[model samples]
Structures are given as structure tokens and as C-alpha cells.
Target: MKKVKKGRQEVFEEGKLEVKLEMIPQLLAFGLSIEQIAQGLGLDEQVVRQAAQPKS
Candidate 1:
């Protein structure tokens, strides 16, 4: 597996879920994996993974 550098750290509780959701794509575009984005935003990897999924 490749090493990942920690990116920007963020906190978006309750009211900021939308903001956090919006950031998922931007972070992905920056080449960050779900784990990295979760670490950066202090969230669970699963939460990031779910949020990263396309809306149905």
C-alpha cells in the first residue's frame, strides 16, 4: 500500500454536515482517499466513504 500524507483538518458537526459533504468531492479531486479525508476532517472512515458515494 502507498503512504498517504495528512491533508487539511476540519470539523463540521451537526449544522455543518452539508459543508462537510460538499468537501468530499473537492478532497477526492485533490487525490485524497476516503481514509485520508476522514483523518483530515476528524471523522470515521466509513462516514467519509458513505459521503463520498454518489447520491441516488
Candidate 2:
């Protein structure tokens, strides 16, 4: 049996982060500022900004 890291287990098993990642762009399209989105989503501004980046 392989032991997965605790942090990885929590991040993958719980989908909150994934949901937040999905919401960033949707919030932006709805005219929310980066700071507003971060506050509403309880994420760091940098994290929200990264999610809003172009996917090229």
C-alpha cells in the first residue's frame, strides 16, 4: 500500500478548491473585481488572479 501525503489527500478528496477555481472566471464575467471575488470566495487575491489568467 502507498501512503499519500496528508496535504494532497485533503486537497484532492475535498473539492472546495476545485469549485473555487471554477468560480473565479464566472465571478469575473459577472463584473466582480479580483479583490471582491477573493473576499467573497475567501481566497487569497493572488490565487483568484491565477485562476483568472488566460489558459493558453
**Regions of candidate 1 where Cα sits further than 4 Å from its true position:** 1-12
User: How much is 5 displaced in model 1, in angstroms?
Assistant: 38
TM-score on alpha carbons, each prediction: 0.68, 0.76
Candidate with the greatest TM-score versus the true structure: 2
Tens digit of lDDT per residue, candidate 2, span 24-43? Answer: 99899999999999999899
Per-residue lDDT, model 1, residue 15, is 42
Candidate 2's error at 27, in angstroms?
0.4
Per-residue lDDT tens digits for candidate 1, residues 1-56, read 12222222233245477787789989999999988898888888898888888899
User: Residue 1 lDDT in model 2?
Assistant: 22
lDDT of 2 at 42: 91
C-alpha RMSD of each candidate structure in angstroms: 12.5, 3.3
The lDDT of each candidate is 0.78, 0.90
